[model samples]
Target: MKSDDVAKKLRRLQGQIAGIIKMYDEDRSCLEIIQQVAAARSALSSVGRDILTGEACKCASVKPGEDFDKILKSLLELT
Candidate 1:
C-alpha cells in the first residue's frame, strides 16, 4: 500500500490504543477490552504485512545487480 494508506492505518491504530486506555480507565468489561486489543493487534499485523509486501515488490523491480540482500534481511528481521 502507499505511504498515505499506511499513515491512515497508523492513525487508526493510535485511536484504538487511546480507546483501549479509556476503556481500562472506565473499568469496562474484560471481554470488551480484550476484543478491542485484539482488533488493534490485527490492525498492526495488517500494517506490518502491507509494509513487507510493498518492500518486496520494490525489491523485485530492481535490476539484477542491485543490492536487494539488505532489503531481504530487513524483511526477514521484520517477520
Candidate 2:
C-alpha cells in the first residue's frame, strides 16, 4: 500500500485509540472499554496485514537467486 493510504489508516486508528483513552478517563463501563479494545486490535491487525502484503510484493520484484533461501527464511520469521 502507498504511504498515503497507510497514513490515512493510521490516523483513523489513532483517533480510535484517543477515544478509548478518553473513555477510560471518564470511567466508562468495563464492557464499553473492552469493546473499544477489540476494535483497536482489529484496526491494528488490518494495518499489519497491509504492511506484510506490501513487503511481500516488494520482495517478489527482486531476483532472489542464492538469496532466495535467506529471503524465504526472513519472510517466515516475520510471520
lDDT of each: 0.86, 0.82
Residue-level lDDT tens digits of model 1 in 1-79: 8999999999999999999999999999999999999999989988987888776877697753446757666675775
Residue-pair clashes, model 2: 0
Q: Highest lDDT, which number? A: 1
lDDT of 2: 0.82
Tally clashes: model 1: 0
Query: What TM-score fits each model?
Result: 0.76, 0.75
Candidate 2's C-alpha runs over 4 A off are 62-79
Per-candidate RMSD, Å: 4.1, 4.0
Error of 1 at 57 (Å): 0.9
